[model samples]
Target: HPWVGDHPLSPKSVIRDMYERALTFTELVSHYELARTEGIVLRYLASAYKALDHTVPDDLKSEDLQDLIEWLGEMVRQVDSSLLDEWEQLANPEEMTAEEAQEKADQVRPVTANARAFRVLVRNAMFRRVELAALDQVDELGEMDADAGWDADAWGEAMDGYWDEYDDLGTGPDARGPKLLIIEEEPQNALWRVRQIFDDPNDDHDWGISAEVDLTASDAEGRAVVRVTD
Candidate 1:
């Protein structure tokens, strides 16, 4: 097939548009991606593009792309106050079998109806965030995962599994109470987490924990000691 002319909607233009969208859509995407089916945000954007013009990227088929658009339209319609409840479920995991967890997520996400492309995008996005969060927690814990009974691939699988189990379990402002940040005291292995209550229901919460050898003598009493057991 002959190459399309250097028109406004050229291949190069499409590629650039994809890149630009990635950057410009970061914040809006962070909100949605952090919600559920983050990739749905991207797919929704792609669907919007398809609406403006007939062509979609070579990597994505028209039907697959259109399905994403329709799915997003449904999301736009159904999304409401209940979104918060769903978010809460994601933040706090309730005891459930893996299959049951997935079933619950499917109810919120509707895995059966969405196209493969949209699903792939959602999974990819969820995995990405889970990996980053796991890595960060690992660093903070200073615990060796090499002996955690998993290889690299296995580790990835574990993280993905955790994400699948909880990512879509619920939605809303976090109800996990306050995030705990443990800081080490002068005594080796002695650690304590800062206790703080969250006042605002809508505000996002984050806390940092670092390995500390010691604080002033007066500060010792203020910092509570935490013990970890097998």
Candidate 2:
């Protein structure tokens, strides 16, 4: 009596109702497909990198010696040459020459904090998508060092591996490949589905505390076309 009178009914009902409605794989897939993305990846980073697309060079992760050099060259090309030269001067304990400091400041392109951070994220994503172990170790402070921070050899190897793997798979944007989309971006649809499931009194049978999960894959309007054998 105490438990019934004092205990909150909402939480208990929520949990119990979910327990009763054991949604099958078909239902899950249907829900996800209703709100799936049109492509394998989101276009946020791809859009950002589009500016460099023309000059970005065709980088299919590097494969051989030429590829490694090409990747390195791409990285260097994106950087203002004077920035590195100035860095060399400032790295030493000795005072930086006025010309060197001025050049560095002047050569500094308009890279906002957000842009820099996003580039780092894209780089990390590239490493991850390639299954490079080094991706896990890269950090914000470590990359800031410019010269001593990043290992060019390791990067080259990762680039090579990534491209090599891609080549073996024979995949490209135009290539025929399968893409599986997941997640229901719209909450309202999912919420409505859950409500319909929970509102059904037959979701959980009280006779023997048994649960009835919809296992059929048919697309019917109502329960009139369905039956339970158990």
User: What is every candidate's alpha-carbon RMSD to the true fold?
Assistant: 21.2, 27.5
Q: What C-alpha lDDT values do all the predictions have?
A: 0.34, 0.27
- Candidate 1 least-lDDT 10 residues: 221-230
The number of the candidate with the highest TM-score is 1
- Local accuracy of candidate 2 as per-residue lDDT tens digits, 1-230: 33333323343342222112322222322534522431211122122223333344566432332322332222232333343344446556376786756665565332211232222222222222222222323243223222433354444543355434333321122111112111112233211110111111232311110111121211122111111111
Off by over 4 Å in 2: 1-117, 120-230
TM-scores, all candidates, are: 0.22, 0.16
Using lDDT as the measure, which candidate wins? Answer: 1
lDDT of 1 by residue, 65-172 (tens): 454444433333223213323433454657555565555545543322333322322222222223334443434232223343333554455445544544332111
Full-model lDDT, candidate 1? 0.34
